[model samples]
Target: MTATQTKKALLNKIECAYMPVSDPGVSAEWYERVLGLKLRSPVKPGSGAIMIMGGGQWLFLLPSPGMTPLTFETTGWAGEGESFEMFPLCFETDDIAALHASLAESGTWTEAAVRDEGGCGLQLDFKDPDGNKYQAWQPPAQKGE
Candidate 1:
């Protein structure tokens, strides 16, 4: 054997991703409808002064604990003030079509469509009205074209 790598990296699971919104409750409701994630609990109940006040692992609903929405100085941010950055949060799924349909059924998807990004992969994106973006992707086929 040589210095060449023999082992590989493996991943288990991703627990959550959180985003900030002006209102947590309302945002949570939207996520539940769009992504099919349940609002099981909150990291903090009344975190913001806003009506749907909360903070936890909610997509565009609330910030993660100790993490607020980005400010002007945050580095590597491709977005303008409150606009979506190029690097949006992505959710991986084997069933992109089903996910898109699920989102469409609820009518909460701002823009959910499937497109082929020049063999980057099969991808679909949906944006919440708040400007938060989420993506579902399937890798390019390794075995067959």
Candidate 2:
């Protein structure tokens, strides 16, 4: 069998995105600021936030109705690779340098950019106020972009 057919057998594209952001607004903003994705559903009156790419992915960021907002605006043990950290939110950006500049100006105290072991991807690390790690990356859309 060809390599292309092998990949088709094993890999499925991400059908949809489901995330629990302590604050939908903050998560939506971060996705925009870093990944350049416009949130499909803004925080409208009596409506929660749902973000969608123009293509096929939709991420629902459900925040508690009355809970205080939380985002990866702070730093601590979250990005330190602690096993207790659990899941980290990973996003893809078309331009990593631009996103990095924006994050630097954001002044929310984010982690430094790191290159992955793989040749093509770059990661900018940060932890939200809730200590949930969020990383933005670029150049690895299809195994090696």
* lDDT against the true structure, each candidate: 0.57, 0.62
Model 1 — which ten-residue stretch has the worst lDDT?
A: 48-57
lDDT of 1 by residue, 1-145 (tens): 5689676658665445556665666667666666666666653665521222122333335544553433223344435544433435666666677777877887755354777766687787676645555567777767665
TM-score of predicted model 2? 0.58
For residue 115, model 1's alpha carbon misses the true position, in angstroms, by 0.9
Please report the candidate that would top TM-score against the real structure: 2
Backbone clash pairs for candidate 1 read none
RMSD of 2: 6.9
lDDT of 2 by residue, 107-141 (tens): 65466665563756777766544345566777665
Model 1 scores a TM of 0.54
Off by over 4 Å in 2: 1-11, 26-30, 54-56, 65-87, 114-120, 128-131, 140-145
